[model samples]
Target: MGIEYKRRYALLLAARDSEYVKKVYGGYFNVFVAAYGDEEEEERWDMYRVVDGEFPDMDDLQSYDGFIVSGSPYDAYGDDNWILELCFLLQALDSMQKKVLGICFGHQVLCRALGGKVGKSDSGWDIGPRKVNIVNSCSLFETLFETLPALTIIECHQDEVLELPIGAEVIGFSDKTGVEMFRIGNHILGVQGHPEYSKDILNNLIDRLLSQDSIEIDQANEARSKLEIQEPNSKCWQEICKAFLKGLWNEYPSIEQ
Candidate 1:
């Protein structure tokens, strides 16, 4: 008899869920599953709050087909112990040739882990629906994103990837940040914006940021106004992510040395 197997993925979350997410979305794990999982496919997703010291065991790395890192409030370049440990974990994933997708802080940390540079953005905060230009479209993602010249995604970050790892290629960028999306080899992809976020989620985030004084009231209002006027291309971003992780691209160049 043939055995049935299902694909599995991991979420290396770098932050704790906000009370709002927990209450409204049933936590960040569900939010990710909703964004990345195929409703028809019998795939499994596991969450590991790496910020809380939970990580997949070294022996179980092969059990997962891909890994996705979640955004965090913490700075990617911070010298915290957990951040360093996450870097080591990312390096191990790269060595194993496992697919890893990073978002927001995840994007910055992946670059740092792979010998790239990440630091505070000199242009200050980038909030709201930001248009990211598709500078290079390889065969893998061209048709998947419908060949759009630019895609807007929700952005809320103060740090940016200053340099890419040696073989990493910049596939997408924005007016505020140079490196919006980067791919390393066939296994690693990083996106600087939040594709999983809905307008409501971003609005909540803006409110929280304002309450904490991370952003001024004027900035928050402007971002909220933009959200009301134009929506981010969430469907396109989700498809790009799905294609990248599901190995839909037939002719992507290898970034490996």
Candidate 2:
């Protein structure tokens, strides 16, 4: 079946990329990306500008078969109202039985909306790729998550979900954080790792960070060093992506052949 007739997915990208223009998943999936934040990229993420200081109900969102929440530099625990709204959006998607995947900050949003709490990490910043253990097994994780061993994931974050939302299940974790992955419902999945990000995307993020003076030179270098050591996508990325996409396919097979 053609992508036009296939499942429609929507990516809520919190971070914008400027240097990269016109990039997509490069697959059969039909999805639209919406970026948030004041940071601008040479290539806009198709972010919606709220003139009335309120976001409209995007029809694409309502029809989306799946949702992917991208990582962000903003903290979910902050006083920003947008972050709170995004959290509610995630919960709404979950309640509607839509497939949702949250990465990094997206992961924290999932936790917080589920009656969970988010807080600063006492273990310091987590930079680079690291091994994450699958906490339990389920169909949502059948091929992708269940029994996955020490999968290396790209990570760069200082805050974590200190508490789990009510009825939330922990899918994976590590020594640094108690919950590495979680799911609110059967079809919703939230991972603290960046499985969809290529090293190039990470680089764009770094460039934006540099321009914004978000991180000192030494800190950026340190994180870059750690990212290399983490060696994201060293087979782990491909496997995880394959598993994740496959899981989605299995969940809702295309209507056409």
Candidate 3:
């Protein structure tokens, strides 16, 4: 038998695992893997806690087939040493045409790194389940998903992308955020919501935000109420993300129909 090649992927975690997440799900790494990873034995996923100054060696970057940047509590526009280094690393990854999937703060930072604009949302925080309208003109979306006009996702962000990078296209948007999702060519995709988050995780985060006084009591209450009414299209979003990262859309029979 011919030697089989293993597919390797990396998760560039940009946030610390909250105590609730640690205790409940083991960690954010496990949460992400559960959402986006294939169960095949030949696939491997590695995590680098970029929030804590950990990163893959520059020379080893190409060994992985894809990279995922996780949501963070930090501002994507901040000039923290690690943030600057991460921007540089993203730039390098961009030049190499590597597949990169950015979530929430990851979405914003990827935009900033690629010469786009990002800043605090004038509309304030967007928390809970939101309906994001998919752009029908996006060939990528057409190739991957059925003719669904929109998808609901859980969002928790105070920052948003004001302008897109050069040559970038907005693939999804919502009533609250204009750039709910974007892409640069086929190699980079950025999503403003958390597809990997479960309702419990978001509930825990909402409680944490209330405890920290980061959000007003009324806002927290409203967010929690909304969560009870709507549900995120998590499975659909996960399928889209996995298809993008693993290059599985080409094999999708929908394209031939």
Candidate 4:
């Protein structure tokens, strides 16, 4: 038999591993792998910390089957050098029609790179579990979500996509944000919530933000309170993300082109 190549994926990490995450989970890479990777598969996953100026070699981009962009504390609209470089990389990936998944800041930056508009949310910060209503008209909705009407996910962001790129479809939304999830053809997906985040992670982040005076005591308390009452539909989200990234939906028709 001929040699078989292992499937590979790239994580374009846009944020550093926080002290808490480093101590608890080894790093954000481990956390992401836990959420999206299949322990059974013999796949290879590489991480590129774009925030720290590390990036994958352009020549090796084609070897990766899919790419994921992680959330970041930085504003996606800022003209920072790394942000600009990330935009260029994303554009190249788009041209290659590689599968790419963006989360929060990743979602916003993906929009910005693909000729869409992104900016601060007029609704202020959304730092708790929120319901994101599925758009029934999206072609993949029936196949992926079936009769599910909405998804509850943990969210932490102040920036949002103001306009979508041409050919992009809004697949999910919520009362607080207009574009909660979107897709471009079969290759690109963007989510504005933290489907990969756990309650403890959010709690720690809240504490850090409070210490930095980023959010008031009452706001943090309210976020914490909401967490106690309802939990995120993490299992459902994991399926959705894995399916999109791993081409599990190849049997279905393309949602957009």
lDDT for model 3, please.
0.91
**In candidate 2, residue 197 scores what lDDT?**
58
User: Per-residue lDDT tens digits of candidate 1, residues 224-256?
Assistant: 999999788887788778878888755333221
Segments of candidate 2 deviating more than 4 angstroms: 1-4, 19-62, 136-147, 207-219, 234-257
Return the TM-score for each candidate structure: 0.93, 0.72, 0.95, 0.95
- Tens digits of per-residue lDDT for model 2, 1-257: 72343344455666544435236443211122322111222222223322112443744566555666666777878657677677677777777777767778878877787678998899867765667876546565565444345666777788899998887888788877788888765666678877665566666667766788776677678768777766654344434432352244244322210
Query: What tens digits encode model 3's per-residue C-alpha lDDT throughout 1-257?
Result: 95455788999999999999999999999999999898874778899999999999999999989999999999999999989999999999999999999999999999999999999999999999999988878765676655565889999999999999999999899999999999998899999999999999999999999999999999888989989999888988887888889776545444211
Q: Give the CA lDDT, 0 to 100, for residue 247 in model 2.
A: 48
| Candidate 4 lDDT for residue 111 | 96
lDDT of each: 0.89, 0.62, 0.91, 0.90
* lDDT for position 8 in model 4: 90
Q: Which residue segments of model 3 deviate by more than 4 Å? A: 1-5, 250-257
- The 10-residue segment of model 2 with minimum total lDDT is 28-37
Q: For model 3, give the 10-residue run with minimal summed lDDT.
A: 248-257
Q: Which candidate model has the greater TM-score, 1 or 4?
A: 4
lDDT of 4 at 201: 96
| Model 4 lDDT tens row, 1-257 | 95454689989999999999999999999999999888878788899999998999999999999999999999999999999999999999999999999999999999999999999889789999999998878765567655565789999998999999999999899999999999998899999998899999999999999999999999899999999998788877877888898887544332220
In candidate 3, position 112 carries an lDDT of 99
